[model samples]
Target: MKIYIITVLLILLSMCSCQTDSSPLPILGRHDISETDTVYHRIPDFKFINQDSNYVTNSDLKDNIYISDFFFMSCPSICPIVKKQMLRVYDKYKDNDRVKLVSHTIDPKRDTPEKLKKYAQKLNIDDSVWMFLTGEKGEILDIADDYFVAAFEDPDAPGGFDHSGKMILTDTKRHIRAFAEGTDPEDVDQFLIDIDKLLVEYAQ
Candidate 1:
């Protein structure tokens, strides 16, 4: 009887462990959350110009998981390194329709649609899966805040603007699922794992 009870307890413990391990990533930003609550925060609606001069909006990205980053065509600092890391992600999901990448330019004055198109071509980016976006400076700055990334113009900063090198992962519902330092390959690898986990979560 003791052995039977021990076996039952072991099974229960294993099930609980599995449940903990499989818990979905947290929904970031200010929210009223509880230990038992399952409500999630979502990304707000937005509109911006893509490399192809088309207006890309939040609705266009419905039912897809996307990675987002901020950059400018003229940035001479971490932008290149970050783009390299972003390319790594792009290469991984280039063929997956369910995945997309949105690169926003903080310097909209210089990164017009035409310029952005040239930049994308130089990078050999597929406009369908990867979009290099630009728009009004103020609007772009406000949107950056929503993703928890910093962006602002500074005369002393390199490229005339300063921003964080963060790659953010968002789900179809626009909930931010993960983020990684765009300069760190190890962090990005972990983020890729998280992306897979989110994909599986949504698949079910």
Candidate 2:
């Protein structure tokens, strides 16, 4: 009887340990975004010019997790705050090969490829893993829409475009797995947590 009880106790302890150290998000309540639609919908494909003026498509980013945010290079307000927060993220993961960062200029009309390159350098962007992209206005809007993010021209607004300052995290499968507020460093902690979770899952 004593031996049987000890075996049962060992099994319970193993199960408890497994639950405590599980990889990936534990099955919880509903997610903020639709995780199911991505599993079944037709994947979006669009080409956009990168900071180098080279075309980048969904296919180009396969097998890597990427974080994307939108801002204009000439903005005088919240854009700078977002960019500063992103710098922290870049510095933390510059040497991480499997991770990438993409910043899309909402005002592509003024942010030419050369201008973007200069802006990136000014920010001390991690060129090895980060890209500041610019392309035609329509193409940029289209790609933003495909990601279920929002951007629109608002001539009345200071920058002529009303864009959200949010950073979205996409898994290697091209599904958006998490989002963080772009202007707040505290919100970036959530981004870091999700990134770590995705990396562990991908490793498996």
Candidate 3:
């Protein structure tokens, strides 16, 4: 009887252990661990002009988890499909102030604030919810590297530039938590689920 009781208690303990384990999303980058502290890879501060011509910096997004991507207003391929998938994300979380979406223009020279403003208006999204940003071409490309998205000027490529169609999910601490191929609806569908999972982590 004692042996049977021990087995039941062990099983109960295992169930309780499972119930208490709650890391739904792993932080997606490298970390540095010391005896007393662990440091994570953080997105650094940046400044850009949004479609509304307002200055946006890393501080603007403080305390908010966000989705980010890169594109140019005049892209001849892939960008439209990526934007469509991003729109689905936007529609799902538009009312959630805890979330925001940022799209940076790779063609900074041509995609000025006025140009981005016109584009944003066509999408009928509030600038506060989804910001279209323009900044130095070099800075935009540099930040793309931080997000692990490939972007650069290419004369032979479509629209005179080459870039990836990736959407990255970032946490409030600036660590990447999830991402998906923005051109693939199926991947984006999975990404949407991961976003919910990350939010559940915060809710806990």
Candidate 4:
């Protein structure tokens, strides 16, 4: 009787442990940017303008994978470096119709569609896969907030806009799977690898 009781107790303990481990963790929101080995919540739905001034909504992003970053055409510092890195990414995935890039302008006042078009042309941005978008300042900020990709206006800054240098990777389901520093080469490489893993997950 004692032996049977001990075995039953052990089994029940194991089951309890399993159940405890199966519970989902609390999700962190944009204001609480997670820095640990934590999974991000699903991407929030949004609507914004594309390079062509067309309305691009979350539904349009369905069934397509995309990489996104924020920048202004006239940014004099890290923007150029980030753009250079993005050029490499653009080259790698330009031929793949399944992949696309969205570059949002932090300086909507100066990055009008015409200005953005010239900037894209100057960089030879592969529009087939890459788009330089300019829209209302508040709209861009809201979308950035949803992604937890930080951006703000700094009165002291030359362009008055400050933004995070993250390269956001999203799946076909319009979910953000991963992100990396836009100016970091190793991070960008890891981002590419993550993109492949996300593609596999989406495929499965």
Candidate 5:
């Protein structure tokens, strides 16, 4: 996760977090510079099965802003804390038609759609509001990098894998807007404000 932090920080260094003048949230990613125009990075296309066993793709979410994260059901360390923060995000926008939450499981071998369904059911959250995803492990890990959430198998780590608990906020255009350390309630409090601010951009 060290590499993920450095990468995110490097991208963040060139951007601002607060739009005090009520501007849109900063797009967080690498940029392709050119004399004519600059092109920003975007979350790459991917697909996975949600808790309902339905296939979900980027095109399905092209019209909505979403929060994305990584986790495994068996995580013995920070998963609970991170999930608590995510629930905060979920409750805040569960009824909003324009928002969704996507959680990709790093341990796809164990965290299947049915398992995810039970997990979601335990929280009493509808799949339309927050999706728990699982797919090919390689694809999952690659997409995790795209979202700046480190995830990989680690024999020495807890639960037999290492991962980051970063909750990422992304816009409809696939640009990352804001993120928070999911283990920190205070950071997530600010993240909630960021979500509201991002929504205001769409309202405009």
Candidate 6:
């Protein structure tokens, strides 16, 4: 009888551990949500021109989950490192139609559609799966704010602009499901796991 009770207790503990590990990632940016409130935040609508000069809006990504980041082509400090990490993410999901990558440039004047095209080509990125976007500088900054990324022009800063190296993951409903430091390989590795979790979440 004692052996049977220990086995039952162990099984129950394992089940509880699974439940804890499987809890969904939180919906960020809830300003007024109470403990009992279950409100979810979502990315707002915006339009921008992609590398191919095609307009991309929230509606365009309605059925897909995507990763988003902000950078300028001329950034000399963190952009290259962040892009390398992003490339890892790209390689992981390149063949999955449900996933996409959106890179918004803070320097619109310098990162025009043509320039972005060449950058993508140099990086060997698939324009169909990844979009390098540029538009009015102020508009791009506003959209960056929507993603909780800081971007601005700093004449004193390196390469004429300053921006955070943050990569955000959003689900099909436009909810921000997770994020990671774009410069940290370990954080990005965990982010990849989060991406898989979101994929499994919606697949169910």
Best by TM-score: 6
Off by over 4 Å in 1: 1-20, 33-40
Select the stronger candidate by TM-score from 4 and 6: 6
User: Count of backbone clashes for each model?
Assistant: 0, 0, 0, 0, 0, 0
Q: In candidate 3, which residue pairs clash? A: none
Which residue pairs come into collision in candidate 4? none
* lDDT assessment of candidate 6: 0.91
- In candidate 6, list every pair of residues with a backbone clash: none
Taking every candidate in turn, the Cα RMSD to the unseen true structure, in Å, is 3.5, 4.8, 3.4, 8.4, 11.2, 2.4
Q: Which residue pairs in candidate 5 have backbone atoms (N, alpha carbon, C) closer than 3 angstroms, thus clashing?
A: none
TM-score of every prediction relative to native: 0.86, 0.80, 0.87, 0.76, 0.88, 0.90
Predicted candidate 1 versus true structure: per-residue lDDT over 12-96, tens digit per residue: 9998887745678877777767898866667788999998899999999997899999998889999999999999999998998
Backbone clashes in candidate 1 total 0
Q: Compared with the true structure, what per-residue lDDT tens digits does model 3 show for residues 95-187?
A: 988899999999988999998999999999988999999988889999999898999999999998899999999988889999999999999
Report the C-alpha lDDT of model 6 over 46-124, residue by residue, as the tens digit: 8999999999998899989999999999899999999999999999999999999999999999899999999999999
Model 4, which residues run further than 4 Å from truth?
1-40
Of 2 and 4, the candidate ahead on TM-score is: 2
**Model 6 spans > 4 angstroms off:** 1-4, 14-20, 31-39
lDDT, candidate 1, residue 10? 100
The Cα error of candidate 5 at residue 138, in Å, is 0.4
Candidate scoring better on lDDT of 4 and 6: 6
Stretches of candidate 5 off by over 4 Å are 1-21
* Tens-place lDDT digits, model 2, residues 1-204: 999999999999998887844556532223345655423322267677887889888777887788888889777768888888788778877888888998899898899989988888888776658888887888788777755568888888777888878887777667777778888889998778877887888785
Candidate 2: count of backbone clashes, pairs at least 3 residues apart or interchain: 0
